[model samples]
Target: MSERVDLWNNGNLVQDIFLGEIKVPVKVLRNDSFQAWYLLQPRENGNKSSKTDDLGSLRLNICYTEDCVLPSEYYTSLRNLLLKSSDVQPISASAAYILSEVCRDKYDAVLPLVRLLLHHQKLVPFVAAVAELDLKDTQEANTIFRGNSLATRCVDEMMKIVGKHYLKVTLKPVIDEICESPKPCEIDPIKLKEGDNVEINMENLRYYVDKVFREIVRSSISCPTLMCDVFYSLRHLAAKRFPNDPHVQYSAVSSFVFLRFFAVAVVSPHTFHLRPHHPDAQTSRTLTLISKAIQTLGSWGSLNKTKLSSFKETFMCEFFKTFQEDTFTESVKKFLDDVSSTESKEPSGVSEPVHLKEGEMYKRAQGRTRIGKKNFKKRWFCLTSREFTYHKQQDKEPIFTIPIKNILAVEKLDESSFNKKNMFQVLHGEKPLYIQANNCVEASEWIEALCRVTRCNQKRLSFYHPSAFLNGNWLCCKATAESTEGCARCTADVPADTQIEIDGDRETERIYSLFTINRSKLQKLEEACGSIAVYQGPRKEPDDYSNFTIEDSVATFHTLQQIIDIVEKLNESHEKYQKKRSSSAKYGSEENPIVGKVS
Candidate 1:
């Protein structure tokens, strides 16, 4: 239940001339007309739209007509009184009060209401009062008055008009204080102190590290440049905390790589830095730390395979890319080679292949593996002619018979040609699988050939228009038929009954099937002329059968039957001659039978 009462602002109810000096209290009938008086009504507790309340009584009661004038004259006097109140009087104060009370809990409405009051010059003082009340509790502003565009605008406008003196002087000062705190800076490594200190903030380390890591994850930092700093940091932290513990060293390195990878590659791009770094004295200390981290990682055996595998999965590309440079590549190769050399004597399946140095190529020859693993050898390739060439170490001669599937796509190399120093990248959609190429052109050609041989075998794609094929474009698709050297029409032979209609201007020819009866004939013509390599000459038209149709009279007569009988006889004669020739080739020497065709 609710009620609304409209009260005019001017004077008291009893003594004012508007009501002609009426008494304070009086009762009136529930349904009285008021044509000659200033009618007043009391607030009630029921829906105004309802004719009667649940108790079967009218909700509102009015005073009857009396010796009274309208209240408009009193309202005019009230305005004059407001004008005389102060330099900035509270005119329309009642309306402003009602608006504030209604919107007290809904803070977003305060701005619009204040703006509305701004248009009315008499209500400035009332509006200023509301603003002062709001600014009294800063916490309330935070809780209820959200800082959106409108709120900001309202605050700015209020401050401009009312000045800071009318409100809390500390509000603007506190906001400035917040803006003064330093934001995170670019390229500044987090200041990590060595020992656990009494008063240092633990969250600052995490906050700054996370900020830096996010940049790394997003590739804001290049792998080559940041790997040293990131890996060195891990090693330093481990050495400082765990001293000589080998397990701790390995765990630290692995976790460090994962965190850096997530930050630099998986986080926001702009937050990271990928600027190039030349090998210089400035970053010597960081580079030394990275080498130590690698050495720590190398000390692990089978016990740490799980964590090491995760590290490998996440940063294998980063590792490989780092390994390609001169300073890091040799060290990585030596480490892997050392590992391989140690496992050679022991019966540990087959040793992992040593990562060879760039510019060096290894060809696999035929050989059987020592029995411990199911697959004696997993296949790999050597970079040759920009693309990779497969070689099984056991094979005497190279054979390009094995099929490689699941190719993601060919990657362009940075260098101009397939040489010793070109860059290449081929992602296989798997985390740890990639093929490097020497150059782009060879990659393109190789990938095209690979697709041709290894396209999905179960389904066939429909023929695509020749215009759709661009010189270097490639994609996976379902083909309906396989034809390597010719158009789809030549590959899928039409039957003898199908007719081919050729259409085009004088310079070109377009071929299409007209009827089933002439297809075989057209196919024979194509085969005889070698399919007109470019259809260079003017287009030729076949004899038109536009008006050819069997007449109904001829079809009902005996002459039609005679024509069909003769055609059947001629077909039988050809069949017999073919059989006789085949029998002669099978039984006698290579010779044709029924030379005269009498049989």
Candidate 2:
């Protein structure tokens, strides 16, 4: 595959001409990952190798994983084990934990695992379980989920899978505007060009930040229900994790949603497909400033820790000073609360859900744990904020009561599930409570009523089975498993919230990766220096490192050490992640599993 780039100065109105391309063999990347900087060789038609220096080198982090997955029948043992994760406490000992342990990176394992769990509607419980375990180890609430552990990665990937449309509705337009109407936001005097105005740049930076932050805070309704549910779980978990710290509730949600997700996407819009191409350098600087400000405000715990003194650059410090207004912080807190809110809201044009909604319906209970002959029975049903109950007759003792919180999803039941019309399913923790309304309108009303009351339920499902489980298999997909996920997605009032799929890439982390990729180049340079000193002749193999020098060697090395010691703490992190990566015992045996499974 080849990547091509062209540089034309649209702003300068100067005749610009620069083209570069690079290609690699298919064999090198087959069923594996390729990550490193490649020389941005000048366009040489179809040439694979060309020694060219005019165009700068580009860092390419690409992975191509092709798995020869056998048919579903062949993986029954493994699939069955994995689907039973909810039943496993601590979640660290479960099959899902082992699945991540075997992967080279959690990123690779998270997607398929989340997709599988979400498919089975088993993701919420596992998430809550793992997060609870993660909380136990969190000595400081601010540092919760700071590491790119499996639980965090699972939620991150889940958002990416479902929140793409969320990102579109929430931040894409603002991102598009910023990318198109380029602005010069470089305020540092050393880096500024002759005509650059620091004051104007600062104003533009503030404007962009205000716009983006405004859009985000106003987009509570657009947040996805799955994300909200996950956030709801996180907020409660964080509060319980640090009972004394009320701010942990806000921090836990914002740490991922804003600091990690939204800010990262704003900084690199191209990666999330919000923009067609990478922004110009000036525009990128504008975005980077905005992202920094947003992250600072989002850091509710860090607010107490750093007090906004985290900025090292004097200009950035000055820039953040402009946000001394309390509105920014309030806005951030409100947005986090809204995103993580589990308090059910009445859907528009629907008000009776809060007070009461009582009707007659046919009821049948279905679940994996059931062990009895079942039949549909006509019953009078009533729903309220506290509980959903059904009695043998109206105004009489209730036969059964389903706590409102227990309700996970209220979706249209597939006719194929029971061969009866006007039927719907109410899925909860214990079993599927099948209800049949009098007619289609009545069914719709009941379903809507149940959903409105349980809309903010922390464990509400993103999807559910449309068809009923019959005999030993699901009629919808013909899967033999009783605990299989629904074949259809559930309807929701919340729009998709956000999709900021950012890997943990701090400034030092990026520098460290670049240094690692080019460590061989540095070694080669040392050899070239040694050879020339001994041979006393002209350089034979010219090194390509001469062209890129944004900093001196001593300063660069000093920055690198800081990358390890200060910013990334690379040495300690590497040891933790690489510990027995090849051994399953590193995570622990299935009989004795470890929490926070590392890669």
Go through the candidates in order and give each one's C-alpha lDDT.
0.29, 0.67
lDDT of 1 by residue, 327-417 (tens): 2323322323222221111111224322211222222122221212331233445432123344455333444322123333233322322
What lDDT score is found at residue 312 in candidate 1? 34
| lDDT tens readout by residue for model 2, 1-599 | 64454433444532223346567656566436777677776554343433577567777767753432223443443455567776764465464664454344566556666776766667777888878877776898768888887778888877777677767777899988887777777777778889888899878777888888888877665566677888988899888878898888988898889877888888878778787655656677678778988888777744432465766887777777777776777777777766777665433223354555998888885454333335777889998766899999999999888888788887777776667889888787767898888998888777665654565776767677777777777778888887777677776433212323332222123323433444454444334434434555555675553432212343333322332232233444455544544353544665235667388
Per-model tally of clashing residue pairs = 38, 6
TM-score per candidate, in order? Answer: 0.15, 0.56
RMSD of each: 40.5, 16.5
What residue pairs clash in candidate 2, if any at all?
166-496, 223-497, 224-497, 417-468, 464-486, 465-486
RMSD of 1: 40.5
